[model samples]
Target: MSNQQPGWFPDPSDAKKMRWWDGNEWAVHVSRDGAVWEEPLVAKTIGLKRRSRWVWVLLALGLLVAVALLSPLVALVALVVLVTGIVGISKGSGTWLRLKSRRTAIGVTAGAALVFLMAGSVSAAMVPGETGAPTAVETAQSAEARSEATPRRTSTPTPTPVTTSREEVVTEVIPFERSTVEDANIARGETTISVSGQDGERTITYVVTVVDGVETGRELKSDVETVAPVTEVTTVGTYDAPPEPAPPAEPTCDSNYADACVPIASDVDCAWGSGNGPAYFDGVAKVVGRDIYGLDRDGDGLACER
Candidate 1:
């Protein structure tokens, strides 16, 4: 679940021991001494438990065979070791086991395996032959014969030395970094620099290591920022929406009289010359609906003929 690799990790179920994280899922294998295995004591309802039980049975049979063949003292020690290993496997399912890196767990497992092999070898040596034990002379002759039967390996040739030139680095003061501050009152999608930024100069010395005319490593020896960087102030726009237009006013005689040019009660002259007069009225009293306020008393269509 975490970035931790597939290996021994502190068990979420139990704090005292480690559990195996198989990259994607938590495996049944748990360990107290870096010897991880699926728990045997778990219920058979689990598929992993059923599979792991077979492995345990095979190991038990192997130990029994070793016990039957080896001498009493050797067999007793092997049996004790085998039993201890089994007990270790059963003890708390890794309660008190600390998590170790995969590399460390691997090393520990390799060491334990080496010890097991050595114990088995000792048991084999202690095993009694069917015939009487071989005499020292016969033992020596057998060892000689075996040595002669095996072929000896020739010595390997030394590798040729490679020619390479050492790398060198030349350092000088140069510009490095600059910072910027924002101002949000400007119009959206617009940017303006308030204060210009100046990059700081740094004096650095480096050691470049090369092999076979190819650069291999570059390490800094000295770095001194001679000038401090100047921060640049910038104004960025925040207002983006367009403003709304005002609504139109209602048309009336006082507001739109110039456009209407209709004869009203305030008209003093025949033509009502204060504002622009109607252009289409004929030279006669006009009849518009039931009102006749613009009475020319003449038959012309112009209601207020001058």
Candidate 2:
């Protein structure tokens, strides 16, 4: 109301203002919100359309039913139906299926049915399908979990065979605790090799050739002759040299000519001559004289046996 008031705000008395020391000049409007409040040139309009979810839903289900009626043909028709439904219905675009209003439902359904029928009647169509695929990742994960949960036992393997031979030799010599043996001489024929040693390390490999039981000569593998607390039985006798290694018995029948009933000849081994007996070989044994004359041509027992 004062005529002498500074022209700072519309109503200087009623307005909230921050007077600042602008260093060299007075600051103008200092509020951040006061920068710009542009006028909206054009207004947006949202058309009021009814909930067309039932519309899209009905359309998708109808398509599915039609497809069931027409297997392969249903595919192209179904695809066209989906696209048409999407374009025709504005409200149900983002929905999983389509719905139509009582008003729009008739048109939507008719368009869908017409297109579906045309596509189906004209051509064979291919359909996208899912079958025989490997199980889902979750299923596989479940199987893995089951396997991990089950208790498992592992089996131990049998040991492989180990072998040792007599004709072994060594070069380096090791000294052993010298132990003396009672000098009792006995006659011997051949020799027996007795080995003695430390816990694991063989200290002696003394093979003495004894005639009967008396020592004639000796051979050593390693030098540390650990004469174990051995009760040495020196024999003045001979061992029966394995009874001269018995000879092998002669074979009664040739392995290649094996047959209980036939002599080695033709396939039948049948009666070859006018008076010859039936010559054949079965697996069973045949006695020459016992079998019928026509039965045993090869002198085997059975007659005409093949």
Candidate 3:
């Protein structure tokens, strides 16, 4: 029988019921006339223990129901405790007779009871006065009805004004420019102003935004040149004068003789005739002015006659 595979088998104490064999021992589950239910094998012999288990189960169920009606949070906690207790007891001992398992069950039952009590207290605190007291909606409606029976005066609020204006023209100055031009008529290294510069004017249009009588912002709408600017013209001299002619060179010959050159020396004579001299003139010579050389013998205008 110890080596037999797990299966349903006839109960040793009852012929009408079949008990599940879990290979190691008889399981707590039994079927009678094809209807299955969990029943400890020792339940028949210990009726007192069975009754005590029913009492605990019934008490936990009652707590769960009561908490569920009062608060869902408490109800969820009670459900978890109940499931944990059932599992712990089931796994501890088949008959729930172990001291530790019984203590666990009792603790779970007590925790559920505490949660139910707390939920009840919270539910009672939420409602003011007694059970016959008016609800929150009823109280609010009564207050509203009482206020409607009377009226009070209220002041009207003043409004702020915002204004937008377009095409607001603003004038601005446009400075003149200066330019240079080369003139050949003027002397070199000299400069003179041809046209005096005059400043110009321009007008700018804008879209202005004002809030509460104060200017907030403005956007450029258009720009127009009211007066054209005059450009100052400067004349720079580029003319250079031609160089002067060089002075005439001095004459090399003497200016005393008119016809031929007569050598100016201590004594001058003709070259063809006999005249002992260091310097001599061979050509015929004539004296227009005083004869400086005294070469003429007959006092004629001729000297060194040949």
Best by lDDT: 3
Best of the two (1, 2) by TM-score: 1
Off by over 4 Å in 2: 1-43, 46-100, 124-306
Tens-digit per-residue lDDT, 208-272, candidate 2: 56554455666775555343343334323343433577799766432333245345332333443
lDDT of model 2, residue 226: 41
Which residue ranges in model 3 land beyond 4 Å of their true spot?
A: 1-163, 166-168, 210-217, 253-306
Each prediction's TM-score against the native?
Answer: 0.23, 0.14, 0.35
lDDT of 3 by residue, 1-306 (tens): 689899999986676899999998888989987799998786467777778789978976776576656664774565445444444444453233234557767676457546645564566676556476444335334544554543544578988686866558899999999999999999899999999999999999999887877888899988899999999999999999999999997664335666787766776767876778787778877777777666676877787664
Compared with the true structure, the alpha-carbon lDDT of candidate 1 equals 0.52
Give model 3's TM-score versus the native structure: 0.35
The deviation in Å at residue 25 for candidate 2 is: 36
lDDT string for model 1 (161-185, tens) is 4544443445454543444545456
- Alpha-carbon runs more than 4 Å astray in model 1: 1-169, 172-190, 207-219, 239-248, 252-306
